[model samples]
Target chain A: MEVKGFWHWVRHTLRLFALYGKMDTLGLMRSMGMLLTMMLSDTVLNIAAVMGMLLLAERFGGIGNWSKYQVLFLLGYGGLVDGIINVFFGYNVAFISRRLGRGQFDHTLIQPQPIVVSLLTEGFNPAFGLPSLLPGTVLLGIALPHLVLPQIAGWWFLFAINMVASVAVVLAFQFAFGSLAFRAPRATEEISSSTMHLLMQLKSFPLDGLGAVLTGSLLTAVPVGGVAWLPCRALLGMGGGVTSYWLTPLLSMVLALVAVVTFWKGLQYYGRVGSQRYSNFGHRN
Target chain B: MAVMSAAGFMGDNALFLIDYLLRFLRVILFFALWRLILHGKGAINGYTLSTTLTYTLISEVFREVMECRTWLESGFWDGSVSMRYLRPMSVFAQYAAEWSGGVAFRLLTFSIPLLLLSSLMGVNPLPASPQAGILFLASLLLAVFVGLGIEYLFSGLAIAFRTHPWIFNRMRAAIGEILSGALLPFAFMPLGLGKIFSYLPFAGQASTPLSIYVGQADSPRLMALQLFWGVVLWLIAGRLWEKNKEKVVAYGG
Candidate 1:
């Protein structure tokens, strides 16, 4: 929280991270009970949240044209995206509206780092963040056994790229929504969280069965489809043909560009008006 | 609390607006998921699109008002639970009243309007028979107590947590979403698992009432089971409250 000069701040942050890393390693010795409790609880929550679709896939042999493994893969992708968000951003940074609404943006303004960099890094929680991925990574492993390799030799490489692009699409969208906090901090503060909830809730839907209009709207307007459906489609060879096979990464790149423009525009507005909201909540140290 | 909450919806709904929008999107997604699964089939294992739509509608409405989430236990988190102890009122009763009032308002404003609109659009949400309708109401009433009891356990168990009580709340909510059949009808469950979950306490919350509404559980046994879980959950909830009441008072907001 100290507003040191730029180089000093960078060095301090590195030192703090090294210390934090050591503490995270020693977390077992320091708070074994709490650590275990969190890990166990996170696993259960992650499984339960995705259990309904999985049960449907298991019992009914998957929804629509999707095979059980395909649905599992989609769930795996969503889980990994969520895991990535948590490990890097967690809810605090991922749901940036809260910090903005609470006038914590002022603290970011004071940091030697750029506001965007601060927003991106402030909520790193690697120690606790990795637990939610247990179910997802396990699911991915389960789905890997059923993988249908495309003729392309770079299938794994392509999937990895899609995964990275999907994360960019999600985080960038969150940033765009969170930027609204600059103008009307309270009103726009929860936009990111709400949209995140919307995305998470709808991301795994087997959207292949819907009509073009509905599917197209879901893919573009909301883009929950972009988060999982299209990516899974690409990976599963359901992208209609080669030209469409890379649709997910393409959509993600377009989304990332749109997100950047929206965010910087919001930042300019934020710089112009600043926040009028007041806060008594102690600054996070 | 119920009346005040009903009034508060009018008083301030800025927070709820976004939540409601998300719920609407979830409902649409639920519909789309079903559309995919049931396409060209007309019906699967006795569930038609209409029935499933009705189920989705009722599930969204009832859970929105009646089902409890982490925020329901905010009194504990914000230390307002201790203040309830200062009053002559029973904390459980107070929560029930608050929840009931909100439920009544939502059933009137949100549920009724939505049902009417959906009905006009050819998805009838009403019960198959008048008796079924009456029983659905009765089952729902039982669910109020069952849900409150469950919320009590959720809050009371986390009464001693030093950090991240919300994790327990999230876990409980996740468990409820699946087991309560609020996410989907237990009909899609493996035959054995469906029957077993139908007997579990969580089923008493969403599954039983919806079952009654759909005329799938007209048997006196389901009603009897709902009654059974109602009493058992409250008793356990009562025990948890007694053990944790002191812990609640230990921290005063």
Candidate 2:
């Protein structure tokens, strides 16, 4: 009875925390603003680019043996997935790294809460979703009918795999950045900015378009390619076999396991190395 | 006397040119170190290393040349504008002169070296045409004006929001960076989506000019649309400034 009660409380607390997280005012406002701006920018540029290219493609009679709609369909779904990630999971790695490096992790240690739960829930960046992505979601819904339903369901499953992968890989990135903060806090800031910049700039394009060598490296090594492209191919009912459909999620699970293990190892190193408390104005602990 | 005056003018021009060249060179070196991490590998949203870096270098030059610092907090707290308004010169004109000086300093120092490096890296800077060059310069100048105007106007939010102006400013900056085509090239998105982005001022700031120079835009008609949006944003900024002028506090520093 005691153990069952404890389990029930845990479940109740998780639900309550998630509910409160959704109510975060500042985060939501900021998200709204971001969504508005990104939507405006993305909407205009994407339309102009696709239509312009399609017109050209029509004249030239399609490049790479794909129809204009096929490419549009590819981009539309790719963008939908991209938008979801940017809205929800974008902050996870950066926030974790910043907190970990600052030894702000200690603050959470004193609380009677789970460390991971606190890290995810402590500060909400609602602005990631409200105005910006809300509209983008509408745009995405409009684009959705263009995709077949069963494939869309499959894509959702892939999205689930991608989310797990995101947590894993992003945790790795955070651990790597945070670990550097022990030696140099400012360095993490630089890394964060550049990584964010690179992801924003690079992730939208078709990975395969860059050709085989680069795509192969990204797929096997970094693995950002798997998040969208793998699922996208599955959704399109293309060359991706049943094996390919399962491949990304399987990889995601393995990567998550590896990342957690790596992070644990990194934590052990941190204990041994013992980070210094950076002081202001030449002050010392 | 006329010949001597002409020689003097030429000397001043040369000095200004040299200053600009030197600043451009320094910035280029800084950027080269910054971008060295990428090592020109990997594609960003369909832009190759060559195209991406070239676009980046151009945009960086525009940003550095046009940046106006302390437009928000200073205007609210320091009474800096009070002094400027009392003077004979128009505040806008004075600021424009400062912008010109900075631009001059950047062109000679940073831009030339970056141009050289990009050329060596096989990155063609822009399509070679007098008309294109003129259009590009004009659009960039308009962007600076629009950007500064917007910054200054929003900086006034410091009066109302108090102590949290930095938050708003950062938010604004982040949104602007993404919207402005600084984050990703505008060319690579879906057609419907790209249409929406082009309507926003961000594309007008970076993407449109770059696209025009790169021959990515369909026609001069699109360039005209870019100009139209720049004007509209400027007008919007002016309106916002007028609406918020009364909220300005004369807090002493």
Candidate 3:
């Protein structure tokens, strides 16, 4: 059944999480060890990425017209987006093609819940999800003081909106690409991962110096710039025009619309035909 | 895994396509970044635009070829590693063979195409000198062994700590990027810092070979250093494995 209303969705999601959140096959000591290690490694990885950019800015005064603080802000935004993706769709749940390819989408279909709600909550993982948040928050804490926003409240409001938009854009983009598993499940099962990797790798790159053609391609063709760079420029007051403020949110809405449509259509086809590869023996990996 | 099954081969093909495309875009982006930074200047720390581009191109291709992770982790984590004990070949020999097979596929499929794409983009793949070319190949061969040493070291750590492969793998790649000069060249760092990083064992992985290729560092001294690290790392990894052999936690009956 399709979940109705925002509160209803939240209720169902919470119930499912409360029931199944403790799905750690690794046991207690191992799980705790894994969490601590993940926290340490994630921090190191995040800091290293940001440090490289910061080092460049330090050496050269700044990257293009952006200051060191501004670059840090951009990376902070990227980390925040990554954290959101991880918390909401941690593990392989975001990689939906695995379900489609391995004929496991039927599990969601057989559930006593809407597929969307199932997906939204099934990957909820806050403990392990804490990895990216620490680094993102720390960097943002440092960068926020350096950025001079004339009106703190308005800037914060804009920051909050931009963050939501960035997360939506990333999730929708990944899902939209991932929905292709309905066609050639085996062939395109991993394509979504490639797309995710594309965004992850390119998101932190300073777009200021890449020139107009490449920058435009990134925005329209890949939407990689929206993950951090474009939103960052707006937040830092570097956006050259008013349209810049609306760009990411608008892109988010458009991409979300596309993703929803693509997902529903794929689901319909999946329900009717079923995955021929489906087997009694589970091999979802 | 690349050579194992039809599904695996197909997966590799898909990955290769996406990887190649990203490589194409990254070179362009990096070229633009350096160009903007240089801003009509001839060089920074004796790295002209040409040498820097060549250095990036070589490092990008070289790093991928040296990758060997999770091959050991997968077996160990699932308890299938014990199956290897029954085979005549030692676990190290089997893994070494497995890693080489994967590396060979990646070199042919991913690395060669990347270099060709770089060449098409006008990045000169030629070494700075004939002597440098010979030295680069030698250093690179040593790099393969050094990379193997690192994989085993980490594998030993995985067994000893009984740690999750997820964090261990991330930690390895993350540390490797900075220390091995994959993210930013050692020369690009502050003068003193660059010199310090260059002496570290990890620098033997990417920096030494690429540095020699780009003519920034063609000294046999660097190759000798790589040899020393390679020997040391392998020895330590072997010792660690022996000490932690019982720590292997194989789940499931």
Better of 2 and 3 by DockQ: 3
Better model by TM-score, 2 or 3?
3
Question: Each candidate's TM vs. the true structure?
Answer: 0.88, 0.58, 0.89
Give lDDT for model 1.
0.74
In model 2, the Cα lDDT at residue A188 comes to 49
Distance from true location, Cα of A155 in model 3, Å: 1.4
Which predicted model would earn the best lDDT?
3
Worst 10 residues of 3 chain B by lDDT: B4-13
Candidate 2 per-residue lDDT, tens place, B1-253, comes to: 2233224333312323432433343334323422442343475345555565666667665665434332344333445656666778745455555555545655555666667676664556765366767777766666665566556555645444333344455555655655666534565454445568777766666677665554455436655766676566667656655676566555543
**Tens digits of lDDT, candidate 3, A136-212:** 78878888889875444477778888999998888888888788787667767667677787787678778877768
Clashing pairs in 3: none
User: Which runs of model 2 end up more than 4 angstroms from their true locations?
Assistant: A1-19, A22-94, A101-103, A120-140, A148-159, A166-179, A220-222, A254-258, A265-285, B1-122, B126-142, B157-204, B207-253
- What is candidate 1's lDDT per residue for B35-93, written digit by digit as tens? 66766766655677777777877887787544754264556555676777777888767
Error of 2 at A179 (Å): 4.1
Alpha carbon RMSD to native, model 2: 11.0
Question: Chain A: TM-score in each candidate?
Answer: 0.86, 0.67, 0.86
A52 in model 1: Cα distance from truth in Å? 0.7
